[model samples]
Target: MLILWTQGDTNGIGSEVILKSFHRWRHRPHRAVVVGSYCMMKFYEKRLNLTTPLVEIESLNDIPMQEKTPDEPLYVLSLSCNIKANVGEIQADAGELSMKAVERAATLCLSGEADAMVTAPIHKEAIAKAGYPFQGHTDFLEHLSQSGRAQMLLCDIETNLKVALATVHIPLGKVSETLRASGLRPHLTALANALTKNFGIQTPRLAVLGLNPHASDNGVIGKEETEFLQPELALLKQDFCVDGLFAADGFFGAKRYKEFDAVLALYHDQGLIPFKMLAFETGVNMTTGLPIVRTSPDHGTAFDIAGKGIANEASFLSATHLAIQVAERRRHLETTA
Candidate 1:
């Protein structure tokens, strides 16, 4: 598969991690091309003192129509940014460049020019400063792909733990109202389909966490669980092998996530806190329910460690592997169908 990897914030660790990950993937079978500023990548290449040769390409067509060999240099479809790298500061130009790369990569995937996409981390604040109104990559991708609703799925291959968020990039106070407004059915359906189609699970068992404390402490803490979750879960169970209303604290505290194929959390931190605790170094964030496959490292652009040359690329590598695996599975399903 030909993967289009985006260069995220130029001032952050995106370039560092991408270069590091490429250095480690020299023997991998899949072909990948970077879509960002050639100068930025070159800067990181020199800073890191790595000899992974970079071959600049004017467009995706410039890539040779063959699997990249171990001896081959990394191909880069360089975009023009014309900004110097500022190691640890957020710059509007950096944000613009990052989003531009994402736009190009997503367009390629939608056009079938690229099999899948592995995005490096983009700084949210910088993007906002750049005048784009996207909450994050998920919503931006949803708009770009025109996918009805995109879901965030976090996975740890080592522990086989997967968590999908019902509401993302929203305030804690608004999660309840948002859930009430949109309901949980769509998210559940998306999660189920993603597990079956992308992860190759046959008859996946799904679990959902409660909205309130102790699932509303049996209606003592809050009414969201009693009034909203229970009824929705009952209907969802008819269509899915799903169980829910589990207390987030004890459910994960007692390691209940392992019993199911995937767990669905009501909000972001509820799912991410535990998942990050378990697999921070190797977590992969996947954007599901999109027309094209997309995944990124679970962590963000670590500004403090941007130019230190100590940034770990484990999560990015895992994201790359998962993107390739999901893309291949999708290809198989398409051919067989």
Candidate 2:
């Protein structure tokens, strides 16, 4: 049984993708129980004309992992807040529900009932406007998991390229301050461990990116690379296959990126702008260093296209598949070890 705790509502692409993906997976040997609002899901269900029944389950034990029929396990866990989810408009009530769904999903995972979690794209601004102090799903989940070392890893299956961010969701001005000598080692260590454990890469070849243009041109532009990044890279090389302090300008050239399994970016835009450009529709955003696996679409809520039935679900679907892959691999290692 695989408990898929979907957070985003039907107004966005989350429920649509979950339903579509469920239709694709229903015939297979798995159980997908949705953790969301019943009314909101019904709204999308009618829109998509979905055939799968939305059974409401109170406990994880209610999931019937072995069955095939209309009677088979299909369900929803409804929440209190309700609003007419305008297809393209962001609403505080919708954002509140989204956050609650995530909170509940984390509870399920921590309680050992769910094997893994696949979250839908969330609108951070909407969430904040709702009075919730949230940066993004990764930060929210890290605190929910009570982990100090959580990291974000991006992978596109088609490209077989994985990139992890050392610092995320911060302004360009603050990235260098965040990438201190004390904190640098833990992010890199987490990246290496997650690459090996989740993606099955042993001795993962990691390329670390520089913070400034031309990698500071040997300290002509900035000193972060030589002062902080290089020493950390040197320390990590003793036990790991790691290299870099490569200039951000030329690091993405064909010859450089192809040689490494993953690139470690100094900050958000330094990494994501290029990543999204290259792997926009196929990327999977994974949260590493958590006890349980969690992944989400590399994209965010398509507010303009929300409720239009036109938002692309490819990224969200990719994230779902990646979550399953990593969880199954981890489960296998646990079984064999």
Query: Which tens-of-lDDT digit does each residue in 241-326 have in candidate 2?
Result: 88888876687765487789999888888788878888999998999989888888888767666655666767877887788888
Candidate 2 lDDT (Cα, 0 to 1): 0.78
Candidate-wise lDDT, in order = 0.91, 0.78
lDDT of 1 by residue, 73-174 (tens): 888889884998889998888999999999999999999999999999999999999999998899999999998989999999899999999998999999
Q: Which model scores highest in lDDT?
A: 1
* Model 1, CA-based lDDT: 0.91
Candidate 1 backbone collisions, by pair: none
Q: How close is candidate 1 to the true structure, as a TM-score?
A: 0.98
Cα miss at 297, model 2 (Å)?
1.2
Indicate the residue-level lDDT of 91 in model 1. Answer: 89
TM-score of each model, in listed order: 0.98, 0.92
